[model samples]
Target: AQSPLALRQNILSTLGRTMLEEGVWTFPFTRWIKLIASELSAYRDAAPPDEQQSLRYLTPQDIHEEIKHSGLLRYGDTRTRVEFAHHTYQEFYAALALKNQVDDIEPYVDTPEARRRWQGVIVLLYGITTDRVKLYSQILGYSNDYARIWLAAQCLANAGEDIPTALSRLQEALVPSQQFALLFSVGLACRQLGRYPEALTYLLKAAEENPASAEVQFELGALYRQVDQFERAIFHLEEAIRLRSDFVDVYNQLGLTYYDQEKYEEALTVFRATTQLEPHNPYHYYNVGTVQKILRDYEGARESFRMALKLKPDYIEAKTQLDMLEKALSTGVVQMLEKIPMLSKMTLEQSVLLANRIQVKEYQPGQIVFHMGEMGDTFYIIEVGEVEVLAPEMGRSSGGVINRLGPGNFFGEIALLRAVPRTATIRATKPTRLLAISRDDFSAVLSRYPAIAHRLAETSSLRLLRDRQIGRRVDLDRYYDPGYIAELTRQDRVTVLMGDIHGSTYLTNAIGPELMVAFLDEYLLRMSSIIVQAGGAMDKSLGDSVMGVFGSNPDVPGDESLPVKAALLAALRMREEYVILRDKWKQQSPEFAHSGMGIGISTGKVRTGTVGAEATMVGPAVNMASKLSKLAIKGRTESEVYIDGVTRQLAGDSFATEPLDPAYTKKKVGVELEAYRLIRQK
Candidate 1:
């Protein structure tokens, strides 16, 4: 929330203290900030006693005087409620206090009220240590205790520490027993990230520090079970149970560990004990039912599953299990409507009732279930037999069969979740029975069940991000920077030209980032040079998109049509320049070579000058031109420039163009404007 200016000043002012580095200024500013104002002697960063008296905020009048004079801060004229100039300054103070391990920082981190109020500031504190892990270790590792220690320890654990060398040095110097919380946090971080061996070592060290901590023991036990050390897992789990009898998580893991070791009776005992500990939890019954079902105790499993459903009516997993049990009454083979991971979180009783709406269909061998490019909403679970997954491959005659899934394996969520065309074909490989749920039913469930919808969104988001990161997808990017200089001349006929690079993600991923950035830098430079030559000003840069303004630059004449002419010339030359770039990169970085961009140009009369805080652009031209830039890119590989009728007419036969479909621009832009695609320069 703090302005960049205020943030810089806060750092400068604090660091400006000559002796603060001697430990005068608290690293994590806490309740001590107020105390420091009252008694500066103890709080001086490192100032000698003689000079400490010169510190600010010595009296009420002095505090009031500085607050009014600085002009950087604005607040109610109350001493207790006065705030810093910017939110960033306050956040910086908080981080500094924590780094110094100030005693009073616990309220900032521990108290819910303070934490929520300062959540924005507190969240950014982690970023401080991101690139300065060494500095963090050297300063907080040795000097700080409690709040700072465990927090910093957890920070190191979350990162993908490809370089364990730094960790080794930090670990060797620290005594885990001396700082129980710090050691425990490090162990938990590693365990969550699947660094099981590293987690085990840290947990063991932490356990040695405090054998009485059931939390530490539980973590150690669970981790041991994960890595297949059943006996050791049971030892620590039992220790945790001895320390805290009501540790439901401990019982759950103990039961699972016993189950993994094929000690069925012992596993059942532990699971039952967990149910006794937390009778209301549906998951406990579900766990018991799962074990019973696997052990061929169908009757017991049915009872447990029924109890789970009774406790939580919307429990999809439990409901699925229960439904399967009912289906198994005749054949003894489990059946499901669909296996959507997030569906269990949804509270759609109506959708659950609609589960009966699912059709059971049989497909003979070689019958196509669904084909690629066909949009579908239905999800299918294999009730019996097998289905072959055929996905498009570059070198295959028949689309390659990627998978042959049998009973229990389900398909169709990808299309249903995204509402997109099927990416692969599904066909029956044998006499296959499928339990199907329609798209309408799925959508109804998602709309009514927010928790399930959120869970599904998380999955889709991760997948989309993964696809974008690897260059297989190009996501539309939009951004606006705050703090604009309001400058607009009302009569200025500005011609705006916008260019967006298409398929950038693919090229960026194909070539390494280093080369791709270099290519973009050179490419943008070439386009920018053309604009500068035409006396146009680059107004904004939105990732692959560029915004340029004409007719307003001091270097250019005040002719209203001058900008439009310059923009057109620049746009035409960009296409020619891109051809050269394409060929060069094709030879130099062949794999990354891809087709170029699209342009939208429009000329309209508008206000363009030094603007105020509420500054804004108002004109039909600005929106039209921006929209056209997006339109020009539609379904085309090679570069193309589309201009509004005004731009084409203003040029007066200087360029060759023909009117495009009026309805296309009208439908897209929501304004009836004569649009033309610029073919070439006359």
Candidate 2:
């Protein structure tokens, strides 16, 4: 029988020939990487447990050293080889770490005993030292290990550069269990570099491998937040907190989720718990304080602020709160004294002291303190029980109560702001206690508390905006400046590639072309409407596919990045539309049923210009976008949308992506092509 090396050599030679004939360089690189992998495996198998250290290559850096000796970097720049090495190492390390083999890791931090045990591992984990640098440089002087060099190139890619080219060179790299981690890191870097959709793809890969990872869930949460999907944010954040209870910041974030839903009491409870967990965290205190204020617990709010200041003395928020409390207290007092008509003859200074001592008055049901339209100098609060403001004469015989004002709830304060008659009749729903603040006293309090004055102003403004009743869907063409798209795209470029359903001739033959056309027409119109309303512009429609651009300024700001984002936003909207439409149509017509369009999005610089006759304008980037879309349409990839490295960089924390092998597809453009797939939690 031939030796293992001989057998491997035979396999390598055969594989190499096949790859060369196929014109796929990745195949050859893969074979080489695998051969090296086999050798390392053999070394591991033969070495005794205790004696393994002599030849032990546990960490990625050890592998890097071996590869450096084998001359892998000779084929490319040291930078590229270093990157590949890092990528390979990270893939392995992350996997090992996930398995809780931290014992195998050397102490990367400065320590005594740690340095003696896992020197190579520690150095690689923490990064280059002077001695380590010298060692690697010496190894590079000679031809390094080809396998390790490839790994180094991958590492460089993880560090913050393009790894696809190097990955293409080493196609046969082992798929470690930590593949998700490597992909996630790569996706994150891509996002930092302005590749939003690409990051979404790579991070999605990470999410798939470790569906329970808090990091991945948090990432999905962030993406949903950007798209204003508050419900989705709640879902992801809840999951993240569930998975990792000690995530620390997630507690406050969860609180915000509740707050956004208008579950004020729930939000307050969440924030209170967060403050308890992170007592020293000033922000938590601030959040709790805000919620307390909203709930009308003036004393409780003051105490929360004081606690916040105690934790951090320079807290501007806490100081601001103090000023507001003082104003409210003074105003309550002055308003009380001014309310008593018998005390109208009292001097201002005496009135001030007397007002400060007035206690809140309790009212019984049907007790009339003052009737509607009667002159009154005071506002009322439900100090103990419930009160109702009724529009008695407004159509109904009795009247409709606008709100249930309960204990701690205040009303009639606006009466102090404006000297208008009561807008509605006020009556006690149950036994109620009231505190009054007269207009003159309120003004005097404002003079003392500037911060409170500002708070009151902000509250008033917020109320006005809320009551304005603007419709949900605003016309982007009118109020939104076309140039704003360019600005948004420049800040965050996204991409969208679209593909139409093909090979439906068989389906149509079975179901009739009229049915097929009807189905397609309905879906296309529904999807188009959805995408456009979501602020995406259709780039063009090619039969079954509609390519669209996001972040594009119709007003012609001429920003190159905008078109790509416009495309991506459109794609997302189309995807959502497809889900609903598919369910409805499938319910109605099973034979003529159809899957949604395939989309591919790669973010990067592509020429955007008008082509065609004077009567028509077309964009070439639209042509480039067909690569991923066509791939999806042909079922060449599992991913519905394939994004590129560039798009991943743009999306950042908002979305994640997965790097994929070059996807192949046949279309008007033709042939196999490299593409990245975008991934995010549904």
Candidate 3:
């Protein structure tokens, strides 16, 4: 009931505030407001109650024209926030936004991030898309909702109402095997609702359906633990731990299960391992001490309590326990230092001294410990869980785990002791604990322990040899799109890895046609395997050179870096395989000993597609890589790898690079290409 004069003044104040807020850094306010309005209208009209709402539909492009013709919405100075000039402006024009409703909800609902982007505002406010319920309920009237039912079941779990009915629908829609995600959701809900028997039934069914899911196993383990089924609980929890090593909650729960069963020693072992896996977790150390004290491992308990207190000084429980253990420590207690495999060989005095400095490092699943080419000043020994070793091939990683290491195994020492860069990437495949010893400390220890030092050398050398021989055969039928056809071309970002044999001509002349042909066939077979295994599309084999394509379908939603990484990995593998081939050929036919390979990689974008029956990926990336390979071929003594600036930038930090002289490609008239010799994956 404001007077007209007062309303005018209020409007002016709002306008001033809007301008001040948006003036700091300007955006297209008019455009933003129109888009927001359009989005809001769709949500409001899609309400399940049905069909009374009307809107003045405006496509995003029609906003400019609508604002120009209408008086309700005013466009102020460019820096001002967009606003309804009149109070009723939005109410009158909201009919404008009704996107064509999707018939199938599976695509929208399958991907959570996409669903959030499309329906987040509505979902956050309503918790369920009301119309989605209307649409889904309508779908149930038909013969089957199929894949779509699972999506609705997922949404129903979020709504946390009508779960029973949704569960029934999901069960009908699901096919056989490990793809029923809704089963896990239902199982977890049942467990939370305190229906242990029902939870057990659904979870056991889920595990049978999808044994690979770590979440399901964890839930199953938790349910078993709740029911006092220790044997079943341990089995499932251990499986969960193996599937995802960094699932920290599972570790604590597993330890508690052991404790509840009065398996004090087993509980102590588990908690100790948990503390090592999650060193910064005060609760983990406290749990360790709890079990240690119960087992009367008083000295170990004292150390555990002290560590807990170190991580959290205000820890009352840890402090109290430490006081009790401190009194017991006067009599001296046994340390767990002798249990460490590497230090098990060391003298008690030496082991104790080193164990004091032995800090625990933890990594989650898929987390990189250290990338290839980083400086190494620490050696790591796996204390718990597992890690995968990934070695880069060409100029990038092939994205395949080359080797796996478990507890008691160690790595990074070759680089630490030899004063070289990290040779490969080490990534945790599961929640993992590693004990790290600094180079300085390890070297000092080694100086005292000659036998252990000699063993270290032997281990590193053997590992290095194994790493070099790790690249296996690749089958090419998987990647190439031979059926590709059309005039429809798209701008494609591509990675190109080109390789040329270094001494094919000399070998051909030296060994004669018969032996030379056998060598060429062997070389091609091995190189092709390397390329395909590293995730490259086999493009073609020129007389003496090979070319591979990556990011063939750039328009697809995928990792932007995949192409470059794949191309690089393939090239490195090809080089390695070629060396082995060359050595074999030299031994068999000494006359043709000059065989070698040179590889080059580059990444860029170009128009690419199939032309008639021929597939083509011609562009700057392909051209540059070819030229770089030729540049690599100039190295008479050794096989070499060269990469362009773009490839280097995308490959990320940690490379052992030597800048090459600025060189000209024959095709480029005046421009000199800047390049670097990628010696090896550090």
TM-scores for every predicted model: 0.33, 0.31, 0.30
Order of candidate numbers by TM-score, starting with the best: 1, 2, 3
Write down the TM-score for model 3.
0.30
lDDT of 2 by residue, 1-682 (tens): 1123333333333333333233333323444455456655665577678655644535433443444454422223422322223333433333323223233221222233423322333324323322322222221222222222223323333343355643333223423543454555555555555566776676677678778778777766666555567787788888888998877667677787777776778888889888778778887877887777666566787888888888899988688876666566556554444443323333344445445644478789976555544544576755577876543231122334444567655554444444533434578868887876677876675657665556655454334223211110121122233444344345334355555554455555665433344345445444444445556654434335554455555466775654554555556555655555556555445643444456766554333344453111123334556665655433421226666556655555454556665434333336454455555523
Q: Tell me the tens digit of each residue's lDDT in model 1 across 44-125.
A: 5555566445553354344434543666334435444334566565555556545444433344545445444544434345
Tens-digit lDDT track of model 3 for 564-660: 7777767766777677666655665775456567788888764454546545666787778877776633544368888888888777654566777
In candidate 3, where is summed lDDT lowest over 10 consecutive residues?
91-100
| lDDT (Cα atoms) of all candidates against the true structure | 0.63, 0.51, 0.60
Candidate 2 regions off by >4 Å?
1-175, 190-197, 333-682
Q: How many Å off is the CA of 164 in candidate 3?
A: 3.5
Choose 1 or 3, whichever is better by lDDT.
Answer: 1
Best TM-score among the predictions, by candidate number: 1
Q: Of the candidates shown, which would achieve the greatest lDDT relative to the real structure?
A: 1
